[model samples]
Target: MTADPLRIGILNLMHDKVDTQLRFTKVLSEGPYNVDVQYFYPQTHYTSRPVPDLVQKISQPLDLKQVATMDAFIITGAPIEQLTFEEITYLDEIHQLIDVLVANNIPQLYVCWGAMAAANYLYDIPKFQLPEKIFGVFHNYLRAQDPLLKGLPDGFLAPHARYAELDIDKIMEDSRLVINAVTKNNFLFSFRAREKNQYFLFSHLEYGKDALLKEYLRERNANPGVEYIKPQNYFRDPLHMKDPEFSWETTQRVFFDNWLHSVADHIATQQFVKE
Candidate 1:
């Protein structure tokens, strides 16, 4: 008999193009599991308001039933005020999703803003505000060995875009989760759900090179006079932005490949069983 395809539900919290979901699907599908993606937009006031074209294009309500049918679910980040979960218009919907996922013991992966959402929902911790926006490729160091980081180098670079940080102390306070990695800025890089099959990443492991430039341009346009006008000095000169080699597409692929491999065992166990 042929093996069943792994049904993967992608909860895209952002109001950007579906490209983020597509990139994630591309990487996860490369492994032993067959992947399927479904997007969910939280029905909240903030999302409903008029916003950028990118946000409008990707906004839609995601059915919860999709969560029940998947072997794994990946939740993308969103742009919102992170001071408190209440401030996020989709706060209730996110909480509802978390409750359902936890009840079903479903495996999940949260990236960037998704990570903050997971952290807030899981720990009741408030998100920290940044003095400035965090953009470009940032380096992360594995604090300990974990399945997600297996076969990967000690340090890896991934794209990031946010102005809020999570409280590591509060995250560590929860005995159910494990901190897998940390950045130099003392931010959580990666974390795992304690009892349930869930993993969260605060970095954009699925972003390609072009995506980074696109995001940079978007931010540059959105906030022209922000204090941090210049890109991070660690990356190559932005003057060579046209070059494809400087893109982080390869890094994104590697990160996704490792994540897929890490979840292979779980995928096998949850493979579709015909009635």
Candidate 2:
């Protein structure tokens, strides 16, 4: 018999949605599990213009009260990394999301800025601003064995576009968190909070083939005065840049498949315990 679809909640905080929906949907659908996704945007994120298509896909304003409706949830990185969490208009609402999702034992993934915010509110870990944007497709060394990194190389490449870094020392100090992945620069790339059944990933493993290149171009166009650097190891030819070489597509699919299966297992356990 076919299994019921896993219902996932997504909060697309990216201003330029582009292929966010496709990447997410495609990745999650890879494993044995099938999924149904519900998109949401915190109403307060309206300060920036929304992607027309993404805005239409959003099911409704985020509501923590309906936490029971989802088997898993995901929050993507936002462009507001330069601002403090409290300064964002949707702070309270997002906190509500973090609290309710955890309280109800929902398995979730928070990428980039969303991961940083969740780590902060949930564990008091701080985000450290970097002198320059950490924009690139970079390598990550596995710090420990994690199901999330199962099918990928022990040290793998993932895409990143951010102006800030997570407080590594503070996060390491949190006993509940297990460092899973790190970059050569020692920046924490991914970690698992075992108790919370949540994963905090600094890199955007779900990026489409040209996501980083697009981000680089957008930044350069917005501030012509600033000399934006091309993403590391991305260009087809460093001398005469062409299309970005696709790196993480297979690994990304593997990671999402693992996450989906894990969430299903966790939810099944939660339900089993209550019976």
Scanning candidate 1 in windows of ten residues, the lowest lDDT window is: 227-236
Q: Once superposed on the true structure, which residue ranges of model 2 sit more than 4 Å away at CA?
A: 47-59
TM-score, per-candidate, Cα-based: 0.83, 0.92
Q: What lDDT does the true structure give each of the candidates?
A: 0.68, 0.82
Q: How many residue pairs clash in each candidate?
A: 1, 0
C-alpha lDDT of candidate 2 relative to the true structure: 0.82
Residue 10, candidate 1: Cα error in Å is 1.1
| Candidate 1 residue lDDT tens string, 138-233 | 677887777767656666766667778887887788888789887778666788877777788887777665666666667678888764443453
Q: What is the C-alpha lDDT profile of model 2 across 164-215, one tens digit per residue? A: 8888888778799999989899877899896778899888888888788778
